[model samples]
Target: MLRLRKSILTVLLAVFTLLGCVAGPSLSAEKTALVVSVPMEGVVGVSLENYLDEAFAYAAEEKAALVVIGLDTPGGLVTSMRGMSQKILSASIPVAVWVGPPGARAASAGAFLVMAAHVAAMAPGTNIGAAHPVTASGQDVPDKELSRKITNDLAAQMRSLAEERGRNAEVAASMVLNSVSLTAREAMEIRVIDTVTPDLPSLLKWADGRKVRVGTVDVVLDLKRYEIRTFEMSPRLRALHFISRPDVAYLMLTLGILAIVFEVLTPGGFVMGTAGAVMALIGAYGLRMLPFNWAGIILLVAGIIVLVLDLVVGGIGVLSLFGLASLVVGSLVLFRAPGGELLNVSVGFMAGITLTLGAFFILAAGAVWRSTRNRVTSGQEGMVQGEGVVVEDLAPGGFVSCHGEVWKAVSEGGERISKGTRVRVVRTDGLLLHVRKVEGENLEEKGAGHK
Candidate 1:
């Protein structure tokens, strides 16, 4: 009986030990992996670069399992694109680029970024490619040799990234060489991308249990128990993005110049001048982010100078008209550079600013011209042609009231002007007025004292 009891106790202990071993790994795996989602929209500039850097840093701090970039850009500066690509390539964790939410494209520089990712994906209705280098104005690169160099360099980059990610390198190079585009299905069929998922959830689900190379080691994504957290741009970054736009920057530059010019012409309250300086500084920051033509800037400055000259020299609207023309031309060419196509300025905004500024300058010119032709109203010369009554009889010289003030006077032709007689001032000699009596008026008809 003792031996049987000992045997049963041993069997029970063995069963419990086996159960503990089976449930141990499952309990440990219950911790959810943090997946960080970063939204990349609009032009890829310094602002976007900064945002991405911050996002990556934050994800690293949180020890995130994966960093997913939700990309939707129409391409942007090449320098910025390269900066962003480097960020992705150097990431500590696995980076996935998803061209998503339908109706989005990964064109130009965006194509390079997508290729740089460890796992590239796209939504059903999305497309990628069209990365041939072009001038800022959207025209073919004018210099054939330079164009070839850029094309080859970009093609090499695309091929290198594709080969590294085990995708079709030749097809990837075609995007830079021929500007060829592909739909989600085409991309999947050609193996240019890993997956074609419709949304974030689908993409995450597909990524589950997939093995990807992180640094030098193969890290299998255990995302079945994953929690996604979206990271957004801070207010400062949002403001930077807003002002980085070519149109917004151009408008700020225009308004700044106008305000400063107005302050210079009026020269009183420094309100316009201060505001103008601030706007100009902000606009200048935007210009630094974009590739701008020097000719356009020169023309814009020249236009403002001409407008100022019109105000100072009081031209008969000719300078104002010329200035308006210069402004229109300058604005049209302001952002026409190698990557200028991405910096799109609205046609309606351009037209409206041109017409409104033209009318304002024309009217201002007219007012200045009219003022120049009119008689002086606030100086020694203003006393001339003013009417007054004599306070004391002018026996050669006497006191008379003119322009609401008493002035010593000498009658013209040295005639005697009686007291209380209304007199007209002919000229001013120092502080004395040269007066002449009205032919039809006497002291009885008019009041003696000036009001």
Candidate 2:
């Protein structure tokens, strides 16, 4: 009996050991390391700001040890860039800005963002810099005095960020003041960035033991054996991001205005009005977010207004031709980046849209307008003095024949008329007509009315 008990204990111990081996990783014995990657590409608009807010907050929510921002963008709005910088400056988790995948760049506002990160990294063949401040037309500060103010301000900002990160401040300032650019290797050699890592795994590997100061707290990155979770922009933000592009915003504005114009020219369309209003509002919001030339915007609006007015006041397409010219010219200079470069929307694109919209207003609108002006052939109301035969002998309220149909009619002058008396419709209140007998119109026995 004792031998049997020993054998059973041995069998139980072996079975338990096998189960433990299979379930060890799934158990809550060790801490779960978290890392999150956020895409920081394109024009840094309000949508990108909102996304960054959510992403940083999520890092805190998930207790993430590292937050990586994959960046590849041209410079964007200064307001949005400043907001992102502040968020990064105040974040609890260490944020690493990586300009990745050979040939990508973090220019202008992107350079500022990278400089602000705890770990500024880049991939080989990528570049950064060209931090100059220019107008939408690409001109630098207008005069020496203005240039001094702009340069000094940007230099001060770059200096502050570089000093905090312990990087080459003079180089960074020169980037803004002179619009200098550099490759990843050149940047690393000049101490602009910490390292040039080719991939995320390599970046994480190099960052494993690094120390970073975030919001007055010094922390070490614990990236070993951590799972990276990529947080993509939400659908709402994605759509907003898409619309925030200058070219897309311009297209939406044009299409929206044309749709609204179509509704006005051809009235009684609820669908067109509702859709046009919504799209126009969205496009306007996008333009407000972007760096647009307000003068061009005003000219565009004036062109549309003049076209509409000409249609209303009657013209031989003369004002329309002028308005078309204004629209085309306004569209050409609608927006240029501070670097003096227009968006990549082709001239052919604008020409096609302008021609199509113009044709609709000129041809379709003209046809519809002409059709409405022909004649009023059929009606029940406003038939006063219209010749009609009294179908029933009228005392006060009786049926009268008019417009090939009998109407419940009352005598306008309250005169008693015989059944054969010819009558005229005075007016109509609902289905009842107020009519009176026509004078000298009862010539033929029963059929003769006014000729």
Candidate 3:
């Protein structure tokens, strides 16, 4: 009986050991906190919108304890910003926007992103605000009533975001209403940001134990036990983001036009045409994310068309001058739309590209003009002015050897020609070559001048 009891105890101990071994890994896994870091830099356009959407989905799937957005942007499209704000507000996990690495800013639409985050932090030397609505060129809206409506709407939106985040709503609204700005420390003092942390590690530590609202429920962040896992934008998204810059898109559009023109001028291989189409599509996609002037686009197209026409019609530089002026003007106004206040086309860059394109257009036109006037060197036209040797004599018809080929011939004046006479080809009628007797030139001299 004692042995039976011992055996049962032994069996129970072994079973318990096996269960503990199996559960240990699972229990440790539960204690590991996951923090997802998403880098948000540059313009908040379609690339950012798509990147954030993917990041949020990934964070939710990983059950992240916190999502940190490392933000550094001048500003971007209002529509894209609104979309990003909606994602932040609707996220199941707490989202923190950190403007860090020093000297970074949350200006313009970036200020709204700061307001949208459950927790907003900025590094030393960083600044925030300047949420005023204006044209892409940073100019005030032209229409008084339209400007007033836009300002009021943006102010209300700013106020709502700050109020929701429990920050200084009045001051936040003033950013949009009066274009106010504040430093990192000033933002903290005025309750615009949660804290000022210099780096991500310090940010995580400062964020630890913070209670923030997630969806309808309030949740506390456990960042102390976190494993910082950075979620990067995919390669394709990174490329799209890179080209999303207004300048890059403008350059791409220019290249696309040039490449297509090249394909049109020399059209056997479709390589240039295909590449131009792709680049044009990409540039269009980038431009679509921003507010652009349709008139500017029309003018751009008109300028290019006129430049091409100059080449086709052999214009004497007048069309070229007008086209160049129109191109520069169009480029100046391309991104200067009502809501594109943050976008800027550098004057130097624009001038450089325009000058280069104008030079290319002029050079190509000159080449085309020269080609039109040059002598023909092949086929029927090549037979004219070519020196030949008459192999058969006749009153009006004979056979002649020209350019190493024999053909039926006739004298230009219908005069009789002796065999072995050196002659010059006047013209070709079908396979027949009209010949004229060469004067003061022997066969050796004529042969030497054949080409």
Candidate 4:
């Protein structure tokens, strides 16, 4: 609940910063300027890479006065982050990277991007630093030589970005080397960032006449323009971003299986099957976009197949047991990419899902198999040897009340029976039942109807 509130506040701050920045100014006084505000949130990925390309291109072509980016991210791929920084560096328009909404922090790769911007700003509650590199598992590089190499290279990167932006390069190096961090106020005091802003109005007002060198030309920012246009990513990107989280993506894949299972359980249904297929596809796409292990996927699928077969073919807990093993092994290594700890899913979550699904399949299938072996308790065949009261006298064949139903009965033992006398069924032929008297006498009646 707290996370949700934080996210909402961040969004509001970003939106207000863009829309209300430099307000109270006459837009028509000078030339009309288009200010493009782009929100860059979440972990960096191919989706982010594409969004950046689109935003930067549009801003350049439109000749916007300001490109305000509301950035709140934990950090992501170094490669993607580097490409984004390069895009900002080469852009003809000035880029303002703002870490905002009080609780927001630009750690790791985010810090690199923040320092690379032409104008770096932050809200009071935000912090920036922790540019150290770790493996996908969130551990220092196991190889000592490799660890030193990556650290030095990354430190160089931080220093270059900070120096280029005219910020504090030494402090930037410490962020990478020592995993140091600074609040918005401290960062500004140390000259690591240009300024601190409480809100969008203050940021824009402060930024009004700042001159920034873009490529080969020095451009002066004019914030007199009142029009603020926000460019959002495509719907496709939005969908991808939503499922990019390790937990959500994993759930999509696992839940997709249950949907398909339900469809199979209730065959010929269209909705569940289609939904399962689509969810699985989207989940698979999300995995492919991340650092993925194909082996894990194959094992996971194989486990599901085995479990399904066990249910269908009535395996005595054998196939399902093996399936459980496969699931456990596959899940552990599923998202173990190069630096997978950054995108790690909880072990408890994976184990619980696996156990729940396995147990359900085993219990439900075993119950069904047991039910098929139970004795037949209904129909005419079950009525053999059942005792009934005679409704009419039976000389050879007459109606007898058998199992609460009137049946055309014949005396196979050649016994005479009176009306209301109890008789036991001997056998059945078509709709007729052969009977004998309770006294062991042969019952016979001439009439078919007993009245």
Candidate 5:
């Protein structure tokens, strides 16, 4: 009885030991290290909001210890930047923004994003700052009052972000007010950035001992053995990112206009017309969202309308020339003032587009003119001297068959005519045809012959 009890105890202990060996390391290991790399390689638009949303969702789901944002950007829209900064500030996980991979920069809006992170870091050869705001066309905005107001608002926001993250608030504010910039080492020295790491390994190693506050509780980071999970933008976000580019928007606008023009030229094709309408609506929507000059849009529309009118009403090329000039001017003024890193359609692009559209319209007008000048082929005027057969009897008037159809006919010399008698068409009035006796056959002779 003692041996049996001892054997059962030994079996239970061995089974418990095997279970521990199988699950102990995994149970003790931390599984919530999320690294969100936001490589903002293009113009910042409303799409950044979607990308930030995706990153935050991933962090929340993983209950991540730290969320690292690997940044490389030339900055973007001020509104988008500010929105992203606010999101970073309100995130539950500790957010670390690392400007990385040698020669990367956090300029303009990027500067604000970097400063807002809980732990701001930089890889070697990275730079931060340069927060100048400008228009889409690379022109500096001239409204002093409005500019001042915007500057103050951005400065306050940056100050608050820096203060909350324990970074240098003065330097952060200077980035907006003075457009100051710094290297990775310089940023760390001035306390603008928390650390300057050479690579991801070094970044994770440095982040291990850092203390980050989540809500009201302070959590000591244990990132040394953490699993790094990366989150990416969804298909919808990716598509938005592509379409938000300045070149893409410009191209869409041009194509939409061209499609509408083609649809107008050939009416009754509802498919083409509907497609044109849809494309134009979408293009207009994108344009409204961008910084554009309303006057330019109006002028562009007027130019197109004038050119179309030239096609409808013969203008001898005068209206066409005026329309071309309007198009050129409108293209130049399309985008409002620009000076920031926002995508801008260049003057050269505008010139190219205008020239192409003008040339197409001119060619189309020439084709229409040629078609109008073509000679008639099948009408009463086309049948002068053609033969006809009498279809009804008449005394000075009758019916004749001509061109496979019947027509009312009258004798030219006030002579009687009979049915089945052949005659020559001498003149016409509306649907009435005046006829003469056949050659070598007088009217009386034709009547006798018919009898």
Candidate 6:
């Protein structure tokens, strides 16, 4: 019994030792990887908003180690830029915004976003800064009070972002208030950015072993050999981006107007009506997304009505001229911004549209004039000089065969005409035709013969 007890104790000790070895505390650090790329080009719009939303949502859900935004933008709407900046500041995970790929820039709103990120980086040959605000059409507004207010607000925002991220607050403020720009090396030297990397691999390599604070808890990053995941915009969001532009909305509106005009000109074509309806709905929706001037819209509508009336009615001297002038004025005021950048319609485009509309009117008016001047080809007026045979009766009024049809006729000379008398048609009056005996024909003989 003692030998069996000893063997059981040894086995239990060995099993416990094996378990301890397998479940021991790991010495290696835990590594995490999260990459969010925002490669925005041209003007910032709704697309950028959607893309940012998607990327942040993914990052928040994944509890990513770090979110990296590959930014390249030429500034955008102030509202959108501010919203993006707030999103970055509120992120639980450390966000790294890298302006990269050589020759890439983060201008205007981009500068604000970069300042907001926990870790801002730039690639060689890249530049950042230039945060001046402007209208949609790239026109600069000269409101001194408004400009001052915007500059102060943006400068404060940049300073806050920079201070939070341990970047250069003064330099960032200068960027907003002075429109200063810096290359990658210059940005890094001035502490506007954390690092200047040649490529993504270098960026990740440099990011390794860095530490960032998350709500009073300092977390050490270990991103070596980490996996990267990218987030893309949804189809619906992409479509919204596509149609949210002023130019796109203008094009849609033009298409709608043309479609409606065509439908009116040629009724009963279901295709034209349907197309007009669809285009108009789309245009209205798109225009609603933009900042529009109601006055301009009213003018445009009135102009269109006048032009349509000119087509329907015979006169065009007053209404047509007024309509053309209204159209020009409405087009000029369509965007309603003092600056040229916010203008949806260019002078060239307006001129072209006006010229085309005038040409169309001229052609249409010519056609109407020609049609009004054309000679009659059918009816009694057409048959006034045509030959006809007396089909029946022998009186001042008789039945005549004209145009292979029988017609009630009367003699203009007040003379009796007989059937098959071979009379000559003189004139017609309200379903009655006047006739005379053929020259040198015996009218009395013909009348007696018929009887």
Candidates in order have lDDT scores of 0.87, 0.79, 0.86, 0.80, 0.76, 0.73
TM-score of 2: 0.67
Q: Relative to the unseen true structure, what is the Cα RMSD of model 5?
A: 7.5
Candidate 6: lDDT of 404?
85
Residue 61 lDDT (model 4) = 85
* Deviating ranges (above 4 Å) for candidate 2: 1-32, 137-148, 291-296, 308-318, 328-451
Task: State the lDDT at 357 in candidate 5.
Answer: 79
Highest lDDT: which candidate?
1
Worst 10 residues of 1 by lDDT: 338-347
In model 5, the Cα lDDT at residue 234 comes to: 78
Cα lDDT tens digits for candidate 4, 1-451: 9999999999999988877666635444477667788888888776887898899889888878888888888777766777888998988788988898778888888898888888899999999988777654455667788778888988998899999888899999999889898999999999999999976667777888889888888888887654678899999888878787666677788778757876887798799999999888778888766776777777787788778878778776788889888887777667766544233245677788889988987886787678668765567777787898778778877889876788888887767778877787888888888988886433433333443
TM-scores for candidates 1 onward, in order: 0.83, 0.67, 0.78, 0.70, 0.69, 0.71
The top-ranked prediction according to TM-score is 1
Model 1 scores a TM of 0.83
Candidate 1, after superposition: displacement of residue 315 in Å?
2.1
Candidate 3 local accuracy as lDDT? 0.86
* Residue lDDT tens for model 3, 422-450: 89998889898988998765555467689
How many clashing pairs does model 4 include? Answer: 19
lDDT of 5 by residue, 1-451 (tens): 9999999999999999999998888777655455554555555567777788887887788677778878887777676776788788888888888888888888878888898888889988989987755555555457887678777887898899898888899998998788898999999999999999987778889889678876677877877676676677778877777766555666677667767876888687778777767767766766654566777777787888777777877555567788888877777667663323333345566677788878877877777777678764479875567678777775788788888888888988888877666788888887888887665554445677789
Better of 2 and 3 by lDDT: 3
Ranking by lDDT: 1, 3, 4, 2, 5, 6
Per-residue error for 40 in candidate 2, Å, reads 1.9
Runs in model 6 deviating more than 4 A are 1-32, 38-43, 100-105, 123-127, 142-144, 168-191, 196-199, 213-217, 261-266, 314-451
Candidate 4, run of 10 with poorest lDDT: 442-451
